[model samples]
Target: MRINVLQHTPNEGPGSIQRWSQEHGHEMYIYHPYQFGNLPTSDQTDMLVILGGPMSPNDDLDWIEQERVLIRQLLADHKPIFGACYGAQQIAKTLGYAIKKAPHKEVGWAPVYLKSDIIPGIPEKLTALHWHEEMFEVPDQADLLFSSDLVKNQGFIMNGNVIGLQFHFEPEADNVREIAINDNQYPLEHNDLHQTGKEIIDHGVPTENKQVMYQLLDFMVKNS
Candidate 1:
């Protein structure tokens, strides 16, 4: 199977998702829509993974809107899509859902409670890295998969193939460090859900986090 990733920035790479694709012997490719404008068409890949970024889907940018159009094309083609953080917000916006400012800027390692059994192997709650100020609403007709104290709409799944997560389940240790070094200033503010740069970087990516991410990837392929 061909799996392609829409990477918004250099820091927010596919991380564990790429590892999963490699281990599963699937063809994986990453595209930088922000830098190169080389967005993939629906027929080019079987599954699409949209990685996180600092930009918002609401921003008035050409590439951002282009990505939304590509997402709609993928949806029309019935291809599976997995979105993370900003990518999740993009998917929600594309689906006519609103992206609102979160009550709190959730940053660091926090637990998200599973709200549905759409995918197996996910525990009741798991600690995942988060670094988003904006949150996506659960799209119409989509199942709310996970929620957190800081954000009510943490994740959602639509049509059993499209999933969106407001947190980082794909980041490995080096990915965390890279994101921390670049996007570290946001969490400097004191908040209940916020963690310092050192804390976030030191926490690393947990084994269970990677396990659940792999489960989601598998579920995407199996259901797609």
Candidate 2:
């Protein structure tokens, strides 16, 4: 299978996703729509993974709209898609949901609780890395999957194939370090939900987090 990844920035690459794809013998291709506008057509991509970035989906940019068009086409074809953070917001916006400011700017590691058993094997409650100031409204047709204290709509699943998470589950230790370094100006002191750069980088990638990501990816492939 060909897994097309839409990477918005250099720091936010597909960390554990790449590992999962390779381990499962699936070919993965990454496209930088923001920088190069090299997104693949829906037919060329067997599955799609959208990575997070600092940019907002509401931005009036050509690449952002182009990416949304691709997402719409993929949904029409019933393609499996997994989106993280800003990518999640993009999916929500494409689904005609409102993307609004979060009550708090959640950064670093935060606990997220599973609200629905849409995907089995995911823990009822677990700490996941977060880095976002915007939140997506859960589409009416989608099942709300996860939530945090600060954000109500932490994740959602639609049509049994499209999954959107407003957190960082695909980043490994090295990937987390790179992301932290790139966004080193995070204001941890402003909120208790936020963590310092040192605190986040030191924890690296938790084993359980990686395991859950793998489980979700496996489920997507199974349904694909």
Q: Estimate each model's TM-score.
A: 0.96, 0.96
lDDT of 1 by residue, 129-154 (tens): 99888999898889999999878899
Best by lDDT: 2
Clash count list over all predictions: 0, 0
- In model 1, the runs with Cα more than 4 Å from the true position are 190-192
15-92, model 2: which lDDT tens digit per residue?
999999999899999999888878899999899999999899989999999999999999999899999999899999
The residue-level lDDT of candidate 1 at 97 comes to 88
